[model samples]
Target chain A: MKKIKLKVPATVANLVCGFDILGMAVHDPYDEMEFRLLETPEIIIKHIDAFGLPEEPSGNVAGIVLLKIQEYFNLKNGFEVIIRKHIKPGSGLGSSAASAAGAAFGANVLLGNKLSKEEMIYFAMFGEELASGVRHADNIAPCIYGGITLVKSTHPIDIVSLNSPDLFVTAVHPQVEVKTSDARQILKKNITLKSAVEQWGNIAGLVAGIQKNDFPLIGRSLNDVIIEPIRSILIPKFDEIKAKSLQLGALGGGISGSGPSIFMLSEQKETAEKIAEMMKSVYTEIEIESFVYVSKINPSGIQIVEEV
Target chain B: MKKIKLKVPATVANLVCGFDILGMAVHDPYDEMEFRLLETPEIIIKHIDAFGLPEEPSGNVAGIVLLKIQEYFNLKNGFEVIIRKHIKPGSGLGSSAASAAGAAFGANVLLGNKLSKEEMIYFAMFGEELASGVRHADNIAPCIYGGITLVKSTHPIDIVSLNSPDLFVTAVHPQVEVKTSDARQILKKNITLKSAVEQWGNIAGLVAGIQKNDFPLIGRSLNDVIIEPIRSILIPKFDEIKAKSLQLGALGGGISGSGPSIFMLSEQKETAEKIAEMMKSVYTEIEIESFVYVSKINPSGIQIVEEV
Candidate 1:
């Protein structure tokens, strides 16, 4: 059977100070999925890897995404998806989002690109809700739109794609799981107005810096005043990693989405690679197995590898 | 002695959802100041209008600003400034910032533009500290920059000038007083994390909208969920003005700086003029004394109105 092959890139959500609003896509650790159209109206799911994720359409992230796409488009044909997982499911690096966004995008493209990026994001959010307790577009928006995205409002689904500068990203995914719900449960329900103001200032500065292409401004604005102070306790060597990354000339970074993983932004590929080496050295010293990737910000979100 | 003629435009701080961070300049209601260089180091201050402002070198907003500038530059020459006031103090129209920024900028020009915008903003903040019990740069930055500005951090004085779009502004200054200190005192010191997230989303969206030049996106992101709800109560007819202005094709608007004055943005000059007329008619019917002005976004900030 002829199949559609897809490469869906991973993403870093809650970019530094922009909690729940800003996200960016990365080039490495893409999930390669293969899919084929069925003559009969029966959706089939298969896994080509040992990730041991669910194959049931209702329970699987990619499965539920395709089901919704099928229902929305009202297609008589069904999809047979063969998955290969690379991004860990709970690495705080948008694993489930890749699967969900990949499924919706692949289906839409196969159906002659019927839906807009906004529509695809909307449908993919269901799968995200199933993975995490809340329906957030921070990760999904970047995964679908590519580059950096601002989720202005999810209720009305307003997503803005910002201009991506020529910057490199270095990410480390330690083999520790931090369920998004658990990570969210630890946060305080209220913050002091002073802290809130500081956070808003940083986020505003970060957005303006990106638009103006001010590298130093971007670095200065990446400090998180609220979320990181609390969430960093969950990851081992979090403080050391961040301090070392900055000392190694990283612009700034923080917990990618919810938490076991960390990401840093850099102006050059060499700096990004150096940060990766630092991450590996620290993790090795701590006797923890981790995966590190140095790549540029992904300008294109999901790609079609080939149709076989 | 040849005099320096300058026009410093009024600014709208807390531009909708961006309280304490984002600000923009308007062309109308500017304070015109005349400065002449003195032979010895003796700063003389004068106000030509019936604004009942203090003229003492230490107690005056313009006086304190000039003193600091003279001290910083160690200039042997003093400035004799005669100010003509139009923007009213306690009108939520950045009146104090106009004077402060005007003094610093005028002195810098007299000193051959010796200081950068950052240094000028720093000197102007002392005057802001005297007017309101806190040091803030939101108003001073835009007054000096002549466009939209983002005060990223005030401690180190980081300000960024955003690209100003071709938008018209209509301002209504109702003759009532809302002190900056009082306006600040009424706000809650703590805000819900949920509301803060919403606010950050809106601010990020607003900055992106300005950079992308998306009019409708700008309109959509102008909703303020925090400060306006508390401070708007201090302004009479605040809710009505906002509703009617939006109905009149204004993107959105709120209390300009704190209270008593409201500003709305429109795409067309005729719409801005119409908003001005509506404001006048509404204030007239309410038996409230008012002043209205329709102008465009002052992209040049403070102008040298013929440096003699």
Candidate 2:
């Protein structure tokens, strides 16, 4: 196959209690990218969208991952990439992760699938780091592995795929930008042992709840004691949206990544869509244009739209 | 049943990474207790062991739980309690929890089994509070729920029973007193956010590992970044014992609760017994009297030997 077209997914990281570990992939608002293998050792990128993302291979999120692929494989031939991103960059919904993981995944497919899922996640982290200045797999792992993925350790890149219950997600990306680097800068260097204990307990409960398919338990454990209290303030009307959504029967949710985006989980698709409408109304009432998505979690990530 | 004879199993709390949240019950060295209901509202206690634990209703661990039972139920009658504790006090095994949980279990049976398992755990906290200054259900919850348990939140009493795989436990209780309160006091009130994140990641891994009954995953998740480094210093030969145990094909384990007692987990019963023998030899060489136990994970927490 000389050309491969991919539908790379958007993801939600942190999942409330799992600050640097948990994430999930969503079905809507993905990026469309096509990779064409070149006979010569050269690279090129073109953006069909007006997002004004960097086309330079080193400056681009997807381009960085592609560069790593070339060097890691010591390939004499490179690839030309075309990008059209529907998931807005800087929306706090894993836009950069989609690009990064898509680059690695697409290249691997063109290279005859030499990379494992973990290897895809590893190469994807460099792209994630380009976007956030931190090498984190919270988003990349889930994007590559699908379902819910827990990043146990990043140094050697250890990740576990968790069981996904029958659940729906409501995501709202308000037209606001909260830079990931800035979001990370605001947190304190240290947290009280008491808060840490509470956070771990909630994380454990959330993992177990998802494993057992217990909705109430999942709802109860979706608490962010450490990160959300500080990061939520940067997003407009964060508290109102979260609290009212809970009242509207959202299992629970918070700042999707670093946040101009907020996502909530629910048991019913009707409730999830209802929450999405409510989220849209809140942004509309506030005179802010927002993109809303109601999706059951993507079980298989990065679909092959066309391969030739 | 007007009279009940109980065998309350011992427990190991913390389970490495889940400090203050995780625990497991073991089948060996259970305490034998008998409760006899009387016509009048008064509590009596007797000890057949030479441990010389306080016999006063409020001063004793089991007695305190009975005191709460009498008051909570507003009973017209109390009970006579005889105790024989084989799990030594301050051994870092859940000796106090065994006694406390046994009292609540036996009392509930004698009172026509009115209390729920959670209620038994809640009432048992008073007895635990007498042993240490804090009321922790890390041990009590497991002793009541059986198998591996996660105490998500102590307040409002949330306890989750986790699936236990076919794993063996090897325990060594060196004769030294590491008071629970003192061990707790030595820990810093705060931890770095990096360490906290590491801890929660491992905790979530451990929970997921146990739920899936994946043994290697359980072994890797048995790390304790926050508590073990500080608490292990209080136990003799702590580092060597843990290191050698891992080398001997043990999965992983750490200080069972506060210290003086160390536990390791393994896949095979023969490996568990081998680890137990090695532990005994270490203490023997050090000239410290130690008690060793090799057993399977307890499924039924407190057993009813007799009821009349």
Candidate 3:
């Protein structure tokens, strides 16, 4: 089998009120992939040391995804794969989604494009389900297509591409890990009717804001009462970082996903970099080491870097 | 207060997946009013017929609404009022909202245009809060100013008037009573996460439908998974009415508010009337006496019919 290389961008899910429903892709943070065609009818995966992936392809996140797709198509091609990770894992920046989506995208291209974008999202979600124990496309859809993407529904993965201009995104990954399982476990099974009303109002407003290109409305709508309150407790100085980011001229920012990282959206590139610096300062004051990424909205998801 | 005549249209709240947020007014089944100037300094009320209204002006639904406005603005004028009920009281057709909004509109004219539409709605909602034990403006806003309205936030009554064309509405009121409290009590405290996602998807589609004036999309969006399931059980032959209405070319219909009434929307006025007849026939087959009304969208809400 021959080798192939692919690149997948980092993504952010749960964009404020869009909890479990919306996601977007970032340009700077990415993961690299190497795929090799094999002689036998078996798939094998190897992590290129940087990604810290599991050895067996079937056990590895990206490898299991490829195996499921191959099984679905009953393909007999054997392959060896390697992944090089740049996006930090557990940063709430969709590092796992980048790997899973990148693998699925690369494999589908290698298989002569048998699936549509919607089909790719469906297949990619199987990889997400493997990682999180539940099928979710909020992160995968955006990682696949980039920019503002709405997982309008999960049953069929109705991905609606929103008209979001290329804006700067500032993200801070603190030296902490908040497991998605632990973060999800803390959410109340039944939200109060009061909170549900507020959440839906914000969700509607956020959708309108994005469509109308109203930044302040977007900032105001980027508020979550149900999940963030419970999840923010897992990340230290979450409130301080958010406050400093806003103080530094960010429209608004919050926990990226189930996170120890925080991200902010800014209309200008300078504001995004400034917000990133402010976030770093706040984390330093709290005695926590952090990595900052200043990027733009990625309109394309996974792409071929070079031919095999 | 000089004698004045006003009419307020009936409103439908919780339009399908909107739950507590969306409402609209129809031209038929409205409440009539005759306001009179009083010599006495105290408010007085009289019921011309068996409308089951309070005799005391301050205690009557309409009178209470006016009194609140008077108190808020420190007005000393007294008024005599009489209301003619046309919309049935317990058919979930916003009967209370009609009376409250009608009184507020009438009094605003009597006081020489002292309040804005926003203020009038705020006063009218106070009357509704007395009846429902909660403040909601979905019905009241439409009763004041018609067309498709979204009660984006209820605390301050942020009303967003959506761009919608004149829609034909067919409504059927089954001769029965379903207490709002009983209907509300039947809903599940916790819904599956899956249902919530579907609910929001429908809402997004519904909003787009209203904005785009797409009748088919509107009909498709008129699906309720949260409130209607529980509330419709209290409406006899509810399923048959919905089925027949759809079969008769009505776009879609569901239980209006907390119900003994069901309503459907159609693109043509003739079809609306046809749907209404179909509903009436279905109720007759079930041996349940019912009343049907076919009307178009009410663009302007409560208005002065005659001035002294």
Candidate 4:
């Protein structure tokens, strides 16, 4: 194929009680990219839709993933990749994962899909490594596979998408910057064994609940005992947003990934919309710009929007 | 019903990564009890088996459970309970759970089966409190529910049975005793946050694996990072037996509850028997008395062997 265009959806990672192991794909606010083959073996990238991201291959998230793929495969042909970024950076909405997964997915399409899904994720994680100074697949796996995904192990990188019912999600990203490193640094190196047991029970229940499609079980199991107590301190007005979300019929709500963004799950679209309103109220009180996305769980991770 | 004879199977609690939360019931080595309604308002318990167990109503596990039921229901009538104990105490094979659950279950039957399964487990947990000095329901829940069970919380005692495939079990209980209190005391009060994360991932995977009937996934997820490392030291040749069992095609195995009894899961009955052989070989080398049980996952927790 001479050219290909793909759309990669935004993902929520570090799920409640799942921390660095579980994630899910959301339908709205995706990053779009187009790739065209060039004669010389040089990666050329341009930001078609801008959020002041670096245009160079080394500094850019998508370009770094594409460059890694090129180096691994030793491709003689180069590609000019066009980026249309929609997901905001540092919002804990998997902005870097979208861009990185888009590049790897697009490059694979150009190569006639020779790489396996696992291989694609391996290549895409480099983008996360470059962006966050950490190599993690929690976000990228869901972005590539769609739906709720589990990264059972990171060393060999085993990932599987968990089938789930049609559930609505409400995500709110307040106009604030919360560094991922700062969010991670505040967590305790050691946790009480009592808390660990409680945390494991909730995680197991959550996984089983999603598979069994038991919504009430999911609601009861959506709790984080290990990471949330410390990380919630970094987010502004975290308690107010979470309390209001739960009070307004949202099944459960917590800090999405690191900070500045909060998310809730609901059974109905109307309830999700109402939860979104509750999310916006927090930022509105402070007169800060906020973005709310109300959507269903996206089953298609990265799609080929247009292909040649 | 005037009289009922019930058989309650032995259970394995903690289940490696599940630590005070997960348990499973086995088919063999059950405690047999016969309950007969009496006109007098005094509980009578007779030890029919030759284990020299207490025959007193308040001191015996089954009698204590039956007396509690009598008090809870305000029953003027009493029961003459005959206990034939086959599972030995301090074996990590849930001997007390069997007796306690059998009493509650038999009493519920006499009352025209008015109590739900959850209520039966609740009443039976007091029996565990009397035996182990801790009010844990892990063993009792599985003994009554008849499958792999998860005790999500113990405050109100929330429990659920996870659906599993037809997997065979091979359990070996050495004559040595490991006190429950000692086993519990050796565990670290706090665990590293990294180990806790890894432990939660395995627990979630194990729950999903059992629900999905994925044998390989179940094998991969049957690990205990927190409890086994410390508790296994109390069991003689624990490492050798586990290694031998795995090498002989057993899916996985670990310290059954606390120590002295080790269990292995296999995909076939023949493999389970082979694992049992491996377990017996450990004790055989030392010329110690050991009991080996090869059976499948019991779907019937407590059964009415003879009823009138």
Candidate 5:
């Protein structure tokens, strides 16, 4: 292909008790990318939306992934990638993952789909490592594979995309940033064995709920006894947003990733819409510009927007 | 009915990463109980097996469960319960849960099946409390509900029986005692958050594996980063047994509940039997009398042998 355009979905990671293990994709507020083959042996990147993201091939998230793919595949051809950023950066909505995954996915299409999805994730993780100094794929896996994904092991990078339930998601980003590093530092290195047992039970229940499509069970299992208690402090009015959303018939939700954004799930579209409205109230009260999305889980993580 | 006879299967608790939450029942080894209605306002208990277990209604595990049921149902009529213990005590095979579950199950049949399985578990937990000084129901839930049970919550006692796969189980009781209290005392009160994350991932994967009936997934997901690391030390030749079981085509296995007994799961009956033979070799080399059982998961937790 001479040129390819890709739409990459936003992902919410650290799903309650599934810290660093689970993530889910949402359809709305995605990142779009355009890639074109160039005649010169040079990689170029540009951001259509102004977010002050690094555009240098060595420093940019998407550029880094593209360079990794090119180097790993021994591709001498040059490429130019333009990104249209919609999922806000540092919103804890997997903005970096979208860029990273889009770069690898689009580049793979040009490479005749030589790499597997897992390999693409392996390459994209360099972008995450560039941003966070950690090669974690909880967000990238779901962004690339779509729906719910579990990073079973990171060393061998075993990731499995789980069956998705037909449910609606509501996300609210309150125009604030909770630096991932600060959130990481706040958490205790150790947790009580009691809490860990309870947390694993919820994780198991949550997986069973998703597989069986038991929405109420999913709601009941959305508990994070370990991380939420510490990290929710980073999100403004976190309690109010969660309580209101749940009260409005949202199945359940918590701080998205490490916060500033909160997401909830509902079985019905109307309930999801209502939950979004309720979540927005917290940002409104705080007088912050917030972004709200009510959408179904995107089953296809990255799809071809247009072909050459 | 004037008399009710019940057989409650043996249960394996603390299923790898599902510590204090998951359990499964096996049909081969069980405890049988016969409960007869008497015209007095007292409860009588007798042990047909030579275990020297308490025959009093307050001290015996089965009698305690029967008393609790009678008190809850406000039944003035007395019950004479005869216990035939087959699952050896302190073998880490949930011998107490079998007795407790058998009592509650038998009494419920006499009460015209008024109690739901969950309620039966709630009452049976008292028997566990009487035996262990704790009200945990990891074993009780599976002994009462069969299949694979997850005690997701304990306060309100929310328990779910997951779908059972067509897998074979091999168990070995090495004729040694690993006190549950000792096994528990060795565990640290806290675990590193990193280990907990890995543990919860395995748990989520295990639940998914059982739901999807994916044997390889089940085998892959049977890791215990937290509990087994410490608890396996209590079992003799623990590492060798587990390594050999896996090498012999057993999907996965670990310390049954705490120690002394080990269990392995296999995709076929022949593999399960082979796993049992391999496990027996360890005890035979050490000159220990070990009992081996190769069986499928008991879909029905408790069944009535006869009714009068």
Candidate 6:
């Protein structure tokens, strides 16, 4: 094996009532990983971009995942990994997941496609656990499989691929840091039984809405009663952005994953772009700098962009 | 209007993980209510069967609903209601819901059809609250509309009719009682975050499965971690009955509403009958007598058995 280049898409998890359970892939933002075979006895990692990644193999998210994969397969040859960061870190767009998933996927392809896609997802999730302190497959599965993905069960890595039509997603990443640990800590340990029932009902409806391509039903079902109420307080102007996006005929929108960013779904590209502009203007009025990405739903997960 | 007779089918609520939320209608095991237009300005109530129902207008479930409806419309004409109870009470089969919905629906038709279906459901749910001490529309909506029903929001009573295909249902009503209030009291106010996520995933799958008529997916999605674990203990031989029914080719089975009665579902009628026999045998070994009802999915809710 000589060299391999891989592209991994960003993911958004916990779409409304689907707390810690649902996720989907986006197209515009992605991360790139390059793998080179080395004759040296030990593994080495080099960061080519200023994402503030670690230089050593053990500390880096991608490097740690690669070490696990090699140990699992008992590989003797060493490899040098280089990560080129494209998606910004801590934007609630799954930056670390892309890195971990991209590294595992790139290594699998360079090593004669040794592991299956599911196996690669498991390995990438292992890497994500080190970064986030929890082995969640919601972000990693969508980053690997693309489109709208449901994490049915995490332990055995059971994933269900949903049928999503050609839809556009508009995301606005505000330049504010809300740590995942802090965001998670604010959530209440106990929820009202009534709210729990309502959440599950909406989740069921959202799943059916996605499968049927019923946009209105999807919009009606994209509601959160438990997690969003607490987590949205972390994002500035979150309620206003969500209300304005719905008012603009963008179907539904909410805080992406843990926040500092918000996303909305629209049926047309023009509407999606309009939503992006609307979100940008709201953040601008608040005097907060933000970056907007208008992209279509990516059906393809991790793929080889180039080879040497 | 001279006289009319209406029959409303039995309903099963809280389909596993969908506790206090989801419900479905079945074909057999229904309650019959007959209404006669009285020439006088006084309402009369009569219970002709041995289902242990109160005959007084205030204490009777159907008569109380009729009184509320009369108060809402402020009508001078009176009605004579006769309820023929076929579905046994204390069976966790929504038997009370059938009588309440049937009376409301029958009176609505008898009084020149003054209310819409949605309004009728609202009035019927009030009757359910009178019996259960909580205003819930899970059983009333399915009894009124038939098929699988989702009560999206109950404040103004918004109901979403789900598309559920022909499912074979086999139910065993054991000679035991499990109070609705007792079954509800045993549930923990706070659930584990992990179980909550799993429950939502299964609910999403169950919604998709019903929409697509995917039996395998429906079978897999019928798992419940929140309510069933505590409620199932109230029913004797519940675990063995569920296991035997599944082994006999049931897609899934659980306590219909509370306990003492177990229900199983299959794709074919023959398999449903077999599951019913298996469930019966399980209860018979414990010296408990049970009655089995094998029925198909009912699409039409309350129907006129005989018109004026």
Highest-scoring model, lDDT: 2
Look at candidate 4 and give me any clashing residue pairs: none
Tell me which of candidates 2 and 6 scores higher on TM-score. 2
Lowest lDDT 10-residue stretch of candidate 3 chain A: A156-165
The local lDDT score (0 to 100) that residue B150 gets in candidate 6 is: 80
Quote each prediction's TM-score.
Answer: 0.98, 0.98, 0.84, 0.98, 0.98, 0.89
CAPRI category for model 4:
high
Candidate ranking (lDDT, best to worst): 2, 1, 5, 4, 6, 3
Residue-pair clashes per candidate:
2, 0, 3, 0, 0, 0
By DockQ, who's the top model here?
2
Question: Which CAPRI category fits model 5?
Answer: high
lDDT of 2 at A279: 91
lDDT of 3 by residue, A211-277 (tens): 5567876787788887888889898888877877788788776888788778898888888988888
TM-score of 5: 0.98
DockQ, all candidates in order: 0.89, 0.90, 0.27, 0.82, 0.87, 0.53
Off by over 4 Å in 6: A1-7, A33-48, A55-57, A71-83, A106-117, A165-167, A267-271, A303-308, B1-5, B35-45, B56-58, B71-81, B108-115, B268-270, B304-308
**Chain B TM per candidate, please?**
0.98, 0.98, 0.95, 0.98, 0.98, 0.97
lDDT of 1 by residue, B166-275 (tens): 89999999988888888889999999999999999999989988988888888888989999999999888888988999998998878898877999999998889989
- List the candidates ranked by DockQ, beginning with the highest: 2, 1, 5, 4, 6, 3
Candidate 5 residue lDDT tens string, A232-266: 98888888888888888888989888877899998
The digit string of per-residue lDDT tens for model 2 on B155-229 reads: 889998898777899999999889888899999999999999999989999999999998889999999899999
Scored against the true structure, residue A122 in model 3 reaches a CA lDDT of 80
- Across B1-308, the per-residue lDDT of candidate 3 in tens digits comes to 48899888998887777787888898889988898755555666666656676767556778788788778867667777777888888879998898888878888888888888888888988778777777788789888878867777766657766654668888889898788888877877767655665666676657656665667767776887777877888888888778877887888879887788898988888889888888888889889899998888788877788888
Residue A212 displacement in candidate 1 (angstroms):
1.9
